[model samples]
Target: MKTRAITGFFFVVVMLGSFFAGAAVYSIFFGLLAIVCLQEFYGLLKKSGSSPNVATGLINGAYTYAAFAALFHWDVYPEAQTIHKLVFLLVPAMLAVFVQELYRNTDKPFQNIAYTFLGIIFTIVPFSFFHALGFVTNTGFSAHIPMGFLLMLWANDTGAYLVGRQFGRAKLFERHSPKKTWEGFIGGIIISAIAGYVLSIYFKELEWKQWVSMAIIISVIGTLGDLVESMFKRSINVKDSGGILPGHGGLLDRFDGLLLAAPMVFTYLYFIFN
Candidate 1:
């Protein structure tokens, strides 16, 4: 218990610091996070009797993140064509994973290669969307954009845990996650909506209606993200994703809410802005 609290404290501190410190810091932090998460994902696959080409996956993810961050954070590419050129590197890098599989001589050659790409899609792509959140409004990379999204996510988690413990009876998904309950899910939505209202008052970047919609998205989609990760763990018969965070399980466990939420939220904000 003490270890969990200690680890959580430091985690929150680093989280806030990376968020507010500026775009460069946020990019560097999440870029590294993307790599670490890819490794851990491949670790899970390995335990399940699959040998994903982690090296190729990691390298590809790193460059993919770098290119996206360059385009968004630094505004390095003035032209959309140039950005496409940068992203085109992923084409060959992805193929390289298949090529590398030949030398690995794994019995499940296609499966290994497929898992390699899956790891990148599941872990890195969502994180890249999260990185884009910092610049969602073209406001020159403030924490407000991403922070608003994260606050709702955190609210949902807290509310769900608290309410689920006290009043949980019916199962939300007995197969993937036994602890979650419908009562808790509703509780999370109510609390997250309240949090979104509070955030709208102070942030002012998004109006009340927008914030409410965001809260709804976060509450529903974010919970799905959690369940999906839980499903992943259940498949591998693992308790936690990794032991890197002590009480937090692993980076993947802690940030699982962002996996599906990030991409959806990004799409929402994009549609709203455009």
Candidate 2:
């Protein structure tokens, strides 16, 4: 318990530090974070008898993140031709996954290819969207949105845990995550909405409604994200994703909610908020 608390404290400090350290640190931190998470994902697949193309996936995952980082850094709009071309570059990288599989003599060639791509899609793409969150506005890389989003997410997680341990009875989704309860889910949403309201008072970049909407998305989608990761782990017959974070399991476990929530939050901020 002490170890978990200690690791969690340092983890939060480093994460918040990365955000306030400037745009470069934020981009680099998440860019590298995507790569590390991809590796852990591939490791899990490998344990489940799927030989994912780790090298190719890692290289391409790094490339994918860097591409998004570049796009976000430059504030490139979708209508720009460079944006189209930059996105076009991913086609070849994705195709390379199939080509790399041709050389592997494993019987599960298609399975390997699928897992490789899944690792990228699961781990890299959402992080790319998260990276864009900091630069979603043309305001030149403000941390308000990203930081607010995280605060609300943490609020939801903490609220759910506390409430669920006390009053949780009805299962939320017994198939994927048995410990979760609808009571906890509602508790999370309420706490997250409160957190959003508080954030609106300080981070005036977004109105209270928008912040609350983001909180709800993070709570609902983020919980789904956790379930998805739990499903992945259960499929592999493993308890935790990894032991990198000591008691926190792994980077993938820690950021599973962020994985799914980041993209959804980014979409809301990009299309609706912007």
Candidate No. with top lDDT: 2
lDDT of 1 by residue, 46-69 (tens): 988888888888999899888878
Each candidate: how many clashes? 0, 0
- Score candidate 1 by lDDT: 0.88
TM-score of each candidate?
0.95, 0.94
Instruction: Quantify all predictions' global Cα lDDT against the true fold.
Output: 0.88, 0.89
Show the lowest summed lDDT stretch of 10 residues, model 1. 73-82
lDDT agreement of model 2 with the native: 0.89
Which consecutive 10 residues in model 2 have the weakest lDDT in total?
A: 75-84
lDDT of each residue in 1-274, candidate 2, tens digit only: 9999999999999999999898888999989888999999999988888899999999899988887787765553445546635766888988999998888899989988888889999999999888888887767889889888888989999999999999999999999898999999999999999999999999988889999999999999999999999999998898888889998888999888998999889888888645
> What is the lDDT, from 0 to 100, of the residue 147 in candidate 1?
85
